[model samples]
Target chain A: MTAESNITWKANFPDSFLWAEWEDEEASVFFHRGSGETLLLNPLGAYLLKTICSEDISEEKLAQRTVRYFDLPVDEELLSAISVSLHTFEQKGLLLSSASQ
Target chain B: MKPLDLKPGEIARLLRSNGLRLQIGPFAVSLRSRLRRVAEQIAFFYGDYPRIEADAFVDFHIQINNPAGLRHWVRPQAIFSFDGFKPFKPLPEDQAFAMFEWGLNWCIATTSHQFLITHAAVVAKNGQAIIFPGEPGAGKSTLCAALVSRGWQLLSDEMALIDPGDLSITPVPRPIGLKNESIAIMKNYGDETLVGPPVTDTIKGTVAHMRPPADSIVHADRDTRPGYIIFPTYSAAADSQLDKVEKTRALVRIAEQSFNYHILGREGFRTVERLVSRCPAFDLRYSQLDSAIAEIDALL
Candidate 1:
């Protein structure tokens, strides 16, 4: 999946959803009640989603923060996974571009 | 006074005239019906519920009347009215008891938003309520009836009421609705006197309602903290097992089973989140009632 060009991804209308997050043995779990969707995310994805929800942040900045938050070496595979998950969230209507906000 | 306090003839007259006012947990209901059988069943089944005064406030005003037409003469039919509005088309007259039970469920599920309502059967033991959320034919009511027979207090047999403020479960104990094989199964296991005769060929395929225990109805104001959420699925081919459900999946499933989860929005989210965080959830499958009862009893 690919995010649209020329727009920054964020949870522009987070209040329209009812959400909760908690840690499980397997992974961090997030539930969006308005979409009836449950997403299992690794630490990196969880931080990205949580940041986007609470702050006005761009997807590029979110990617940079994930690496710093995890204290990991910058890797292409990690960035690619975050990009795909962000695109999925956009398709699910959980996130929208800043231009549409 | 209880409905059973009046004689059968007197109950019929009261229902026909001023209607029967009764306190059903958090709601006061006034039921009016001209049909004698409706009066008899209500007196027989709801005998333990406290009667309400004539001047008391009523949450729902419901009536079942024989429709005024030739169909009432030819085959006989009943129409269910709620607060002066008929929400359903007429049904077979003999299905009046089933109609009343389903109609009242609809009223509560539709109107009561202060509490999050789930389509689940709930019972409490040692002051901890366990919710069994299931679809039709999932044997939820059967499991609930078995638990209630084993001295567990029935909170509800169809809807689990969760207060949005504290995430506690309030008791709205009503009759346990059993269908098809469950009717005979409950009758064989518990007192036959507690189970009404099966109403044949309704939309749910031969439905019967078992009277809730007297204590459950008497102490209907009691609410319990939620302890567990179990999804019970009955299959003759599968062995009895209780598998732990991950908290995240459990949260989504409960919201899916709830009638007002989406309507309540943020409050609904926080309620389920708090509930799932505190309680352990499981996926329970059973072929026999005895094993199921034993396993569930061990959960407490």
Candidate 2:
């Protein structure tokens, strides 16, 4: 799948994820965990994770929200790029396609 | 010979056996009971008119006639139960040693502790402990006990001692409290180290505990940086796995787990805030001990 695909993901985060976090000290990874699939979330991925939980939407909408919150310059190129990233996430089963959800 | 009303000498003897040196209020105690562990250490006392005191650490204290009558006393200030296997068959032992440990925990917690007391099993490695603080049957203690065979050290079997001053978790690798099916469950996962005979009926079916591995008890007082605070639940239908969770949420969850959160009040909020800012938190839903160990080890 490419980034432009318009689908919403459908994976439920567990209760323990309430205070989940990730930080890099000395370039290493550290994050809280729950009793489900361990979803590796870096800064951008974590931001997206929070955004999706806050509000579910299509890839187009997701890109728009990212731009709105993070102040990324909105453009077709950026949207397409984000869509591609989201597609990879769907393939890995980290997030469900909005349509499927 | 009431459990809660301990003679000073009894308290000192326990600390001496465990090699723990402690001073409570004005009572000073030392013990060497660290080498052995039992199923349950309950200190029973009687009195609504006269109260008792001790400088010792214990497991559980029973105020037969609480001096603070009519009050639903929930939390304790100090405690120091061990991970020794003792059975509660036939009849029960004095367990005065266990009583002292629990009493001390109550005293300390009431005096300076202002957090909730959750029935969880916390473990640590490299001075970093994960606070698996949750309610009964949350599978916290069960999962925690299983990890011992996998090399994870036990930080506590019941409460997560959150230090308000530093916001770091104090090490409390007490006995791994097990109840009902858990007692048998531990036998299946690792070499059985039964504590006391099962205390039947009360609640959670037939209940018993397992002595934590030796290393865990020896380092019971050692402080650990709170690294991960997970709320785990055991589901038999599946293998174990770890899920990533967030901060403001962790704050709320910790608030839920506090035994005396309201008592701790503003200081509690500040302490929790510090924890949220520094420690990693998660929501775990797993059934496999091996899988849990591998995933948790990665976090470490």
Candidate 3:
């Protein structure tokens, strides 16, 4: 187990976020009412944000869920991509992280 | 009664005296101007618009006049005022009519928070409307002028006023503004009589306005459902093409083009969301007006 895998992540203001998704399109539009900011997210980014909004999850579990949800191979590439998205969401003030117990 | 029903002299008298109150789409504007050019242009371009009574409620009280100083006689300048407050600096006297048109657009776009306003050109056929949202020099007005000439109703050549409640676009059909090469292009493409003489050396380069069709003004009260949202780019080297835009990207693009999206906040987001979800969006690139019109016509 890696140290990064134990970090838990969740939406910063889950109640203030609004999402609009079209089934035919791979992208989604999200609005954060707390900051009044609108952002465009790809399918993977959207799924991670949505999952975090529902409940707090550790990085390892998130990666496992993402792999199962997208039918993606569990490898270093997928883990790296998910890591980048999580950090990006943290930077955008859309998500926050903490050390897990 | 329409402005055309009154003689030119009467129009000028109303403008200089108690002000000429005219019904322009959803708003009533009272215009007071001492300039002969301003009076003449209003009579010429806004002839189809209905004239309101002196005692009626007015949405915008506008005035365009020569500044009171030596500047008035020397270089000569036109000043635009909204409800007696000057919102912009004085411009050259020759640009008074253009200033009036631009000033009215500012009044609507800035104050009318009742609707979500996007910086777009809208034209409709058979009760369905297509919104062309683009920046300056993107040929939106040019395309709008062309479409109107081909019998489409001009909802607006500048702003798309979307009713937040219903998501229907309200028609505020006014004169279609043309700039530079486009002025000549529209002249050759449509009725030459409908196009006004070009005023050179203005802020927007050489500018002219095409008179809105009388039928469009007559049915100004009718708002149409949005059918398509198209972002147009005019590229002389590229072939005319219409490509699908994802709704998510479409919403972001339209929000960027909007004048008061931030002001409306959540309601604005929901309104734009509904609009994008309801309409199919596309990015249209074209140089030839005929082919562009045909592509847009096929969508309707």
Candidate 4:
């Protein structure tokens, strides 16, 4: 595990996020009022942001939650994908992270 | 009273004097032009539109006239001014009428903040509207014209003014602007007499305006709820196809096509969300107008 993986992250503007999802589709659209950015998210990206919006979580925990949520087997590939998504969300200013104590 | 009620000399006199005030959709526009072609085309294309009284409030005061000094005689240029400020550079005098149509589009897109505006063509049937949002040369105007010729009501051929409050599309029926071969295609498909003379050598290249159906202008006050959002692409090699589009993808595509999406901010996002949520979207690719029209007719 890398040091970046230990950081805890939460949605940057939890209250400012407006989301719309359809029952039959895996993709969803969200608008971030703070940044005034609208984004379309695939199923995994949508699930990750939604999970993080509820509470702060470490990358390891997030990967585990994602695995359990999607009913996928535990694997390093899943963990690496989750790490990349976390950093991508951080780069987009959609997620904020802090050092875990 | 409609513009058709006035004689040719009277239309010219009104335009040269205090300006011809006409109620276009929801706004009252006062147009003053010394150019004879502008006055004539206004009467030809907008004959069914209601004329506002001289004393009534006017939303836009527009003037199209020759530029001052030697440029007016040398190159023969026409300048478009909103109020007193000229917003665009002068074009050739032959393009004076096209300039008026484009200038009015600019005036409405910039000033109308109450509605979420998209650079799309809107057409209606059975109280439901289908919005075709695409960039220029995407054949939106061609498709819109073809549909209107087949008994569909033409809401607008340029922009879709969507009410944010209820997501209803406000009708702003205007002459359909056709370019290149689309102009010739529509001429043969519909009433050739309804089309204005083709003006060539402008920025858009060989453009003409098709008068909206008389019934469309008469029913301009009626707004329709959004029924479908379709992105159309005209390809000579492709067969007519209307494929389903996911709602989230549709929302993003529509936001990209909107003229005032960023201006309306959160309200714009919410309004578009409501629109996509309610209306099913499709990606339509077709070369044949009849087949395309048939596919669309099957939608509603």
Overlapping backbone residue pairs in candidate 4 total 0
Off by over 4 Å in 4: A1-3, A73-77, A98-101, B1-4
* Candidate 3, residue B132: how far the Cα is off, in Å: 1.3
DockQ for each model: 0.32, 0.03, 0.74, 0.74
Give Cα distance to truth, residue B143, candidate 4, Å.
0.8
Q: Among these predicted structures, which one has the highest lDDT?
A: 3
Across A1-101, the per-residue lDDT of candidate 2 in tens digits comes to 23444466544442223323324321111122322223434455666666665656666566667788768777777677676666665665555665655
Error of 1 at B11 (Å): 1.4
After superposing the true interface residues, what Cα RMSD does each candidate give?
Answer: 3.2, 11.0, 0.8, 0.8
What tens digits encode model 3's per-residue C-alpha lDDT throughout B1-300?
A: 555477789989989999999999899999999999998999899878998887899999999999889998898999999988999999999999999999999999999999999999999999999999999999999999999999999999999999999999999999999999999999999998999879999989999999999999999989899999999999997788999999999999998899988889889899999999999999999999999999998896
Please, what are the lDDT tens digits per residue for candidate 1 over residues B240-262? 79999877777778878999887
- Per-candidate TM-scores read 0.88, 0.53, 0.92, 0.93
Of the two candidates 2 and 4, the one with more favorable DockQ, higher being better, is: 4
> What's the DockQ of model 4?
0.74
Candidate number with the higher lDDT (1 or 2): 1
Write the residue-wise lDDT of candidate 4 on B1-300 in tens digits: 554578778889989999989989988999999999998998898778899988999999999999998987787989999999899999999999999999999999999989999999999999999999999999999999999999999999999999999998899999999999999999999888888999999899999999999899889988889999999999998999999998899999899888888888899898998999999999999999999999999998
> Candidate 2 docking: what grade?
incorrect
Over 4 Å off in model 3, which ranges?
Answer: A1-10, A56-64, A73-80, A96-101, B1-4
